[model samples]
Target: MLNSVYNKKQKPSTAGETTQSNKSWWKEGILYQIYLQSFKDTDGDGFGDLNGVVEKLDYLKSIGITMVWITPFLESPMVDNGYDVSDYKAIHPRYGTMEDFDRMIYGLHEREIKFVLDMVVNHSSDQHKWFKGASSSRDNEYYDYYHWWPAEKGEPPYRHSLFDPEGGWDYVEAVDAYYLHTFTGNQPDLNWENPKVRQEVYDIMKFWAEKGVDGFRMDAFQFVSKDTTWPEFPEGHEKDYVKWYGLRPELHGYLNEMYNKIIGKYNVFAVAEGTGSTFEDAHNLVDSDRNELQMAYHFDAVNLSQTPKGYSLLDFKGVFSKWDNAFSEKGWLAIYLSNHDNARLVSRFGNDSDDFRTVSTQLLNTFLMSMRGTPYLYYGDEIGMTNIDMPNIEEYTDIEAQGKYQSALKAGADMEEFINTLNYNSRENGRTPMQWDASENAGFTTGDPWRRVNPNYTEINVAKQKTDPNSVLSHFKRMTEVRKKNPVLVYGDYTLLLPEHEQVYAFARELDEDKILVLLNFSESESEIELVELQGLTSEKVVIDNYEGTAVEGTCITLRPYQAILFSLG
Candidate 1:
């Protein structure tokens, strides 16, 4: 619990929306990602469903989240969670009926919250009807729906999967052929080269848009296009499948076509999840003039340069700085440190200890809200949710986690060391149940939860934070309100002030006469920052600081542990 007293009177409205850009609502509003199955469960089935999400629209609204991205709940075989879609248009039975989804969309509209459904176009569930037919025989009409290699060859090309040791090629004994699966064997990759396949995807998109969904968050969309030839890597770069197989020239044309067919026609928010994207890909996919996508998220900051000890902030600076300069003119980037595929932010980057948890979480929020992009907040991130270390590997339900655990044991890795890695890097860290209150199951459900709730729910639940102004949730609400009110924060020129600084992340955002300086202490100990460069500016005010009554005295301020302050300078 936050012991420091906070002033709620200084907070603005509880909605993070603005008319900052005439471009669209998607650009002007903040986005929050919710893994719906772990969000809430109303059916007492221990699983979160569409009905449960409909029940929590007000909670999202309370947190000032204007746009919500719900992860896939579409019909699936429950292999890779819901990512292995069996039906693109229908809701899963465990989730709820399609009518329930319609009601949830309507509920979101009632709150003026934009709804974005997860669109997984990279692949489909191996049990999907089309795949079923494709694997049945090459003579079937759906034979070309998936990527299948010749059975006569005995073995398909060796395609590597970062997720599994068997790689991306999975043999189908029924067809005596190999089908590509970038993920698990249960999820086979689709053949985007097929025009009919593309058309089928478009029709699915049309189904949701016609039903009044606000947007689509395409999952691993960059992998949709790849060279059809499975060429063996000329040695030494075999694991470079992600880079060589992605960002093909054909992808831009496919995106442009999709943009024109659905996104442009509906004027809907569209962002691709390009995990291995580069700045050049960013420019090609999202530059406004290209008419491809509104924006796309890359994994440079989240996956690359990370180690067991921890991630390097210096490398983080390099990644963000690269994208900032790349998208400074025409394109837009997404500002997020963690998502469904990664661990919790506080657990990954900030100190989650009791002494510094609150301030560190606030500091992370400050960076997220003040940055020049659509800030994406994970469901529980708003309340500073930390990672949970499950007692055993069996308790982890995420497919990737299970795969890694089994693979590690096979490799003779130390059990304790492997568990430590899972503790720090598992995707299941983000899929834990949302802590709504201090009650049983964190008030997410009366029945058993699909996943174990973080035991810290007693101190970190929303019920406790809603009324406490100093709570992490309260700080997020205030920061969101600030971003909504300040247009410069959304549309402004950004400059890195202390790129080489070890413990402090300092930057400035300026738009004409309106300028603001952001200073973030990224460590858990106090430090004195002497802003000699800021001395040139005499007239400035400390507009937003997590600490109460923080002052900017004579260009030198003693920043408390994890303190974040914004000074308005003209």
Candidate 2:
């Protein structure tokens, strides 16, 4: 057994700065992403609501999460699982009233946990008042709130919409104009270049901050800017749409202006969901100058897959290199393997065996938490949650999944192949209700859940794992403790070790004179390490271990399947 050290008086190196500092509270915090509809159902309405989340505050506290990023609960038509917001200020009736949202904010602050709301400013539901008004007449004052154009004689703006089966152009017969929807036709992309639109968004953000929300998770942030000319790509098989501008040069200017005008007023955290962003793009967005966002989530590591379209089996080397290069001393990365938009990490990376599944999940948690950035945990992940393999299209709640299914059929994809793709890539995997117990409806509610609960909830749930010290839940608790107790784990420089090892993943985190080594066996087989390589370190201590009975010898250490070990060095 390893003895632990608690440095109570050790002041954090980045302490005493403004709470909004990119290097302050955020650096040491752990963020929990709550897919609101699946967390808890308080009104017995069969859907999780803000009040339901408030009722479960103790559960979040017990897990030691410092920040909570709630998926959008705004008024919507449910077209995109709350991503297509119809009203930014009003909470959906199904989720609860604004009062319920306010109560949640107050409760979180009282518990010292920051509340971050999802800001889906890139697009709005076509049913939104603004979009409805814009579509009513071409010359309406609100017309500029969305992208509208006259259909060109020869070609449409772009080929079929990525999220629409009908294509990119939506003919609004009411105004005799065509609108552009980068996503679904029901979700018209917002016209960010419009000054009035910009102000409205800024004011909306300020309203939330003033109402006591601590931060905002800017969703689809890179999609806010588009090419001025709306140029079309040449006919070819190229994924890179250079002429179709994204992360435009003007993006930084707009972001800085918004930050200063709305976000700068209160000490609030801002993390951009920078999907499809290059390393250089991330650097510009998160650099310590306080000009752009405090931090940004990168998808490079998560995008590693065998398939050209979506995620695939684990490719450890590819993931490590992406993370190692994307993060820097001046900027931070939001380390996450799964979120409400993607499949669960265990299902994506593990070998599909129950025991190995648990081990692999714990391994991912340990490796991610031990790295040099703030870590975000999706709900139910700590308990080794699996993906929901819904059988039919009607069982799906995500708009993207349904749209893609239609496209697959139109593109001549066979029914079997299309079903296989949906099984692996549907957002339903992450939207499953929390598995609280083995009872009917997984004990998340007496009423039916909005989505299906994982069928394995009986064997894998909080109630069962809470009593088992060796379970994945316990491992997660221990990992959180490790992060809080070690500064090097939170603010240190990260260096990857054994880049070429196929089965073993190793890395060292160094902060001044303190160094910590984290090693993991990614496979089900035992791994052997040469003892001499680790002997050069000055001081040593075993801080954490996933394998309970394993013994570490001087020169060599043996790691059981999916085992992770953390060692301290002076």
Candidate 3:
């Protein structure tokens, strides 16, 4: 019915009659996200560098990745691990020199692997030249580059800071004014309302486009546009923050200008870090006719399992299904489970215990690759990396975790409970060094690593899984190959099955004469999934399965614990 709901809307041409050709490279290719600092380290200075990524091109190709999204390697204060950019056009010495960056870029292009740079324009590190000038005097040329309110205004209306407990406004004695920072105090929010500031951001994007970068992942862009009047937000408004701060009507205007000035000219696509608060808001940002962005990367699913109680299977299914149905007609979506800002996929959404880690990781990957949108797979997920077991706040290196810890301490919250939740939900859990082998520092670095490697690396490293036929890495390779070979999986009509099933998530993707049914068991108990809606159709072949063999009689099949199976239907 959700698919039919979109039938009345204008429809675009499908992928193909038998194989895909109509879709652009971005829509057809698989995207792999590499958190630059955690990926690999060629230099022994404890930081991962550009040459480290250059060395892994062949490995990325082996996993069937066609596109790579690298987090900020641009010059930064590293206050937020490269998100607090001080210089957008220059490479950070911690990452490597400009020459090394060019080599990395050339290596990717030579392998036909598209590169997507992380664009963090919402804010700039206070150490930036523009911020320095802006804080110098009221008459400074760059004073308009950032948001500032004179201290004489009594107290500016309240705004929440994600990192600062004091609030979003920080008093700068140099100019006797307060500047806005939506994140850490060291990172000041840019004034997009100013023409000069907007031009600066556009120039930054163009600089990358000139470097042959294929695309950009705009970080925290949903909150870029502000009301500027700095009206008082009602108490408790921070609970539903995006509704108040995101998708201002003026944002579309800026996006339209950016597309005409840079994105369209460079033939590059842009995906926002998040959509606005509603389905309508999401559509307005990314619909093709809107000419703003190419895809919406929403957070509804990623935020679901952030609590100690975990998430329900039905709620998990609903979030994804709702997103898919919302984008069925016009706009597009970026599908993912885990990323640099969240805990590992297996730890958050699947069973991470040794008994089921491999199967559960494979099952989750099957869901991601089988979905309708372009899937974005995080690095280290291929080998089933789980969360780090950190008991004390001192073990954490992420600013987010440290901020939360201090906030809880100041609020008189229970430290033990907070630490327990932090262990399960901290973003640092996902930022640990990649487990390349069982060697010292997991083969990520020979010298001291910036962060401690996960202790289980000896058992779950890539070298251990690389040669195993049934390893998580192998299943990932097979699933990607299957998706690459089947157009139906990429651009198909998704129809949910077993909508009320507690443990089994089932769906069918059909394009023309080709139809594939996917079944995933989300629990440790065996699940009997009877495809009642698909009674008349029979499976022509077992397309892929996590388990060695799949047993199906008619339209019913028994799914083993954490099993994933795909069947080509006749």
Candidate 4:
């Protein structure tokens, strides 16, 4: 079994019996994701580089982070923020040289932090040599490297382009054909059906693995294998497009091939961007005997709320509970609230308003840490960063936002309403410069930042929170500590308590003789929760609490606004 590597020794339970631990470092270790451009800047360039990341290795270790996933800094035109790979073997000059990358990896390893490279193989930049050759002439050796439809074919089947509202096919005059780009025109989707393309991708992985990259987060990989026949779908199929275009049966063969050729050879953790269209699809990709990926990273919970109306607590609970139940026995899961592709965690999930921000942020962190999977904490989230206000469309920097705005204009959508909603959902809201201190540009850079820093950085920053023991930063560090000490938190069974509770989310984790109860109040009002499941178990000492204190009596607890508490049960 793939998880056999996880078999180890666990902490002794209260019954004084030592149990075998199913703790995989990838499963037990907390992952910190660094949005490269905003993390820290060296050489006064206003852009973060590999050296800047090396300088902060100690800080990442301070927060109890055992693994770090840095976003793409590979050679690119920066068209889709390094997702469009121009050269797989070279480092972009803007970020730094190959030597810097080697040094950065060494630094992370020195701190015992595993490195996870963001592998974007779904597409390549049009400027890439292979793409350039493929586009130049149909007779070229790289002509079949990408998907193309002949101009004489009278337009390819309807395909959805996430970034380009216009369409997924772009006509290239040189080859008299249209190329497919699920994202933007500059990013042409690679033809995974081709054996050569698969080998090319495997070779790239081998190169990185040789460089000591501990793992690979396959970006947009669910969409990598497509139906080359380009079958047409009924109208509005785009709404549930993942079912239509993602996770084709053939993708499994390619994944198995890659696993045998690269992943298994390296013995590294591999997680895909999306968990196909259903639970069965997710399991097929990640089940231990499947010999494919190791972890399932789904967007069900994050996609639940994208508007100001907020999401239903019932829906939130259902989504998480259903996923946990699906993967409880066999496959593994990745737990996270927000990442580079979404808005700030606190702003979208927790209360980002002044009075509730701090406590609410801490509450969300508690939920993440106590969950049944590896928690991926985004950079700047430890300091409780809020979404920056971008009232105007002109202020947005993400290609997804800009391209979608153009599409809305062409569709005659309400421009004012669009910008307002985009402000709440634009990924750029989460990509702002990291708030390091109260200094200019929040001390992320000595030079003017590439993007505007959030004005709230004056009050919300690592420097300020580092001193306050009750601050969100400290709370995050403590949660990591608690999780590290409790092996049950990583491999224990999760049972959702008070599943229909309006303002409070409660759950319990248990492994053999050790049991833990976690309660979280998601709203800004004082809430009380009485867990029927807690009646038999005697509540022991508080393991960790977001607020200064927790009020517990019998089977009930009065939770203050955004209060979160975890208690051991005897």
Candidate 5:
């Protein structure tokens, strides 16, 4: 019955259709993510601001980014890089004023680029007026705005949290209650069960919509709806918060309520951070007729490959093929390899060795751009940026990275090796200042950056790549050019080619008579493209290639190490 309600009332009827006229910008457009603090800084500030993004509108437009998703630059304590919102209505002073935000939005619109702001509604900073007021006394008007358990009765109920120094619950002496925080103790989870709190979030969305901002990327969205009964984690599952702790039943109803109130009314899309979402949950969240989220960043596809241990091509194909089949006729997925929350793709998921770094990244980029659903490119990712070797924990500024390091130390793990792992896997990898040029601080800032710029910026930067046709940034620009001209890339039937390959990830996207095949050699060893699987669909036109010359030789296509070539099939 619930599925029926979601399907009949909310899911878009056009999802099953493989036509070019999907009429949804979210499914067709390219979404570029901007980690605002690391993007660019003006006024000599150590951190980047909204005004800094305004200055880069032309560059973004030139790169063919259709929409921009700006990370949380709202007023925050910076405990979680702006995820802990202290004020929903105000901009962080360090990131500039409300007027600067207005300018950035207008400038993006001027460049024909839609803007999506990070909507961190799952939790708020403990310093927020509402949270502060709620903790002050039980009699306060905002006392029920957050989740707090009275400790006077008994020990606070046991639950899992992704962030808590000691445990999930933090005791407050002022009110003799333990407040819940899905993240850090300073960030308390909001009570979505409370109608008033939900209304406040809706009002916040309305305000931003009225300001002409396009959409919201819901952060930690799965945790917003909890059981509230204070259920314990199942036996043998104590600290695994990501799996057993999210996607409660109440979440769907609440999201539906929010969708009807704001997103549906405003004609703007909402893409949820679907870290914990299962296949059915993802379908329920983004299925067109479902009246819920428009798209989601499902990690099942990327996680299979984005790790320091390396990944197999079969694993990569399996994950994406699973999603491709799951959302084929109903929901939508966000095609992204890197974002502000994860490590750099080239250094993590990709082979960033000297011989393969550029071409390997180009191959990955080609695969991402040619995939079904929208593609999201994180800042600095287009220029083949690799993770920086942050040798010391003292140089790290990410709260989660620090917390993980402290946890590792307490666990008595090797500190040196742990730091190495952090450098390879930390979210700070993606937070490094954007490599704009060969200037000091990579032209991101004249002043010292809030985070260190990657040292490879001198060779890998927008300014250098803009003129080099074979550069990764140029490859990205060319891929977008191809994507923009091909509707099949946006709304087409995806068929995995050579799924059992050991070092190649190839696939074809088809819409009616028009089809394009994407072939990627994910190895540093030269390989041959197996044409037997391609059947009679021969390469009609070479759309793009990372290497200069063609490798097609009759029935067998010889691919250079990490080479990628897209062909228009006849």
Candidate 6:
């Protein structure tokens, strides 16, 4: 049985009671992401449900995670997974009923784990009652519930914009109007400009909160409002079309109003998925004064690359510097190496070899968890899960990958090149079923999983890692313990040490009288550092190491391939 580290009403510091304070809970708390579809299947339905999550509360609490962020389980058409909601008030039948949702919420609360649900308000499935009524006729009271435009002279509105990836926009012949869809044609963008729509959304949010959800992770939040004029961008900047809809000057007013009406009254935690936002955008949304959200997940750090493909090659120094500057000047940042939408960190940053992957994973955890921000851990990240190698487009479930593959082919790219890119960068790599054991389907299900399990489950399963003291899972637990034991890591000032080191990352976190230094060797070879070089911090004791084990010395220290060390100094 999983160990119980938390209990109802136990003090936050004691591991039993959930903390109610807004001051530092976010700063010190650890958030775990649960992709419900692949977590655990109950009743052998070949899909994970709310009941499955309820049964795993003890497993989460045992790992020292304080917050649980589950992706959308609301009623949806599943056009883009659950992102296209048909009814915000109802639960998806495939996942479970509303009663099941309540049970999961109360169970999490009983275990002192705050449950966060995905709030997809940016758009709704075309089948949503609101969209349905609006599309039936322009004279309907719900006509203004979504964005709609009419073509001139029997021609459609400027086809210059690629709103729907499938080529054409949906039109209601009876109403003689076309609706705007930023993603799939089946998902229509909500008209936030309408007061009725805004009020309705607020009421829906309150309804869920009253049901016992502790918080929400807003999806595509920045795109809620758009320029109603639908002005066409200059043809010169066709490549930058995606940016035309984000962070309008009027966005803050809409967000502030929504927060005041729905989020403010409940005093719940909220984190927006500000996909195309800068640090300034984050500050405007989640400053300390709590004007908007409590925090936001920014994609700046994750966008770094090894090729000039998406954003330029990953610049370590530039990325760290930007983060340091942003957090110091604005609000706290949410640090993560991988999520449900990105490739695994181990595969992206370290040698594919198990030993090196283990070390690099630990190093990443230490660096991110020790920083002055909330840390989020993806499901399999704690045990060093690698990216799944998808053999063909048919094996992928993510719509973005499929669209990109077809687009690449249309753009004259060879099939082999497209496949290679998809294998390395597609989001499906992160969505494979969790590796729980070496048993069939990685022990994630009694039957076949919705998605294929990683073939490496035999070596990377959680069952084996939990029993091994030095496994990546154990290292993650140790890292969490260290964060809890040392207040410096929880509420400390972060200062990057030796920023000039090309292959080494070093930093110091200090709080009051306590100080800790984190050193990471980012390469597959040994690196040495003089004790005096660590900004007057003498290597008093090696608290943890990703190498063989922690070793203490007087003058200098050596780190093995992809190793990391945490030292406590007086």
lDDT of each: 0.80, 0.77, 0.87, 0.87, 0.81, 0.74
lDDT by residue for model 4 (1-570), tens:
112121112211111111124446678778999999899999898998888898888899899888899999999999888898899999999899998998888777777788899999899999999999999999999999999999998978899899998889999999999999999999999999999999999999888877877789999999988888778888888889798879999999999998878777664778999998899999998886787888889999999889888898889989989998998888888999899999999999999999989999999899988998889999999989999998987777789999989989998999888888899988998899999999999999999889999999999999999999999999999998999899889889899888778999999999888888888888889987777655643334788887765556677778899999888883
Error of 6 at 267 (Å): 2.7
Candidate 5, 1-570: lDDT as tens digits: 011110112222222222234557667778899988898899787798888998888889898888899899889988888999999999999999988887777777777788888999999998899999999999999999998889877987676556554667888888889998878898899999999999999999888877876778999898888668776667757555556667887888888888778876664788888746468777777766677787867877556644367777788888888888887877677898888878888887678877778888988888889898889888887888898887788888777887787778778998887877777788888888988999999999999888777788888888888888888999999999999999888888999888889988888889889888888888889887767544544445788889876646565787888888888884
Clash counts for the predictions, in order:
0, 1, 0, 0, 7, 3
Q: How close is candidate 3 to the true structure, as a TM-score?
A: 0.95
User: For residues 49-71, could you state the per-residue lDDT of candidate 6 as single tens digits?
Assistant: 88889878788878888888988
Residue 189, model 3: lDDT of 93
lDDT of 3 by residue, 1-570 (tens): 001111112223221111122366678779999988888999898888899999998999899988899999988888999999999889999999988988887788777788899999999999999999999998899998999989888989999888887789998898999999999999999999999899999988877777777788999999889878788999989888798877789899999999878876765679998898899999888877777888889999998998778898899889989988888877778899999999999999999999999999999999999999889999999999999999977888788888888889999999999999999988888899999999999999988999989999999988999899999999999999999999899888889888888899999999999989889999999988777644654444788999975666776778899999888874
Any runs in candidate 5 off by more than 4 Å, and if so which?
Answer: 1-21, 238-240, 275-277, 305-307, 533-540
- Lowest lDDT 10-mer window, candidate 3? 1-10
Tell me the TM-score of each prediction against the true structure: 0.93, 0.92, 0.95, 0.95, 0.94, 0.91
Q: Please give the distance, in angstroms, between residue 24's alpha carbon in candidate 3 and its true position after superposition.
A: 1.8
Pairs with backbone N, CA or C atoms under 3 Å apart (clashes), candidate 2: 531-555
Tens digit per residue, CA lDDT, model 2, 481-538: 8998898988777777767777888878887898888888877899988545466433
Worst 10 residues of 2 by lDDT: 1-10
TM-score computed on alpha carbons, candidate 4: 0.95
lDDT for predicted candidate 4 compared with the true structure: 0.87
